[model samples]
Target: MQIVVKDLAFGRINMSIEKDIQQQTFRNSYQKATVNIIFSANWLTEQIKIFLDEEHITPQQYNILRILRGSMKPLSTLQIRERMLDKMSDTSRIVDRLVLKELVEKKLSTADK
Candidate 1:
């Protein structure tokens, strides 16, 4: 799904459309689907960001925490970094922020036989 908005002197108008269509002709008839989807996704992302921003955390940090919590076992920085959707270049830094939030911890495990 996607939405498009245009600003006017008086106000703004928005339009939305789903991606699926019956045929190429139908798709062509709707010229704004791609643009609408891009705008909608961006708008939704920004709204979510506003919520996370209140906690002084970035969107990537929130995702990392969720991945760690889902693991239920200790994960190495590399492991967590590999699984992240955004795949940030600095996984250690992201981990540090989560550690500061007390939502995650780093510890060494005993070697197994």
Candidate 2:
């Protein structure tokens, strides 16, 4: 079943997940909610990609920039990777690219030196 409701705050009509995905049935509410969450996340990612594309940066690079911007001090590649949304990304390689772009700089810590 599809439910359409007026969104008072946004002054828009909101459609049910069923209508959005064009699927009318699920195993249960939990399954429906899971699908909704995944679908919403993907939609949001696409929206973000559109904006990020103009800046000539990938989502992973943007993630690193945000991480660095918010940190009180410089962080290592491992630290940045731990805080990244996509942990599986190659943080070192992204950082190297950022260095090439002059978006971020790399420094050797006293301990590493």
lDDT of all the models against the reference? 0.67, 0.82
Q: Give candidate 2's whole-model lDDT.
A: 0.82
lDDT of 2 by residue, 1-113 (tens): 11122322323434588988899999999999999999888877776777677667899998899889888889998899999999899999999998988899899999766
The candidate 2 region of ten consecutive residues with least summed lDDT is 1-10
TM-scores for every predicted model: 0.68, 0.74
User: What's the C-alpha lDDT at position 83 in model 1?
Assistant: 91
The residue-by-residue lDDT of candidate 1 on 1-113, one tens digit each, is 11122332323434434433223343464566665666678877876777677667787887777777678677787888889888645889988887887767777767531
CA RMSD, predictions in order:
9.8, 9.2
Q: RMSD to the native, candidate 1?
A: 9.8
**What TM-score number comes out for model 1?**
0.68
lDDT of 1: 0.67
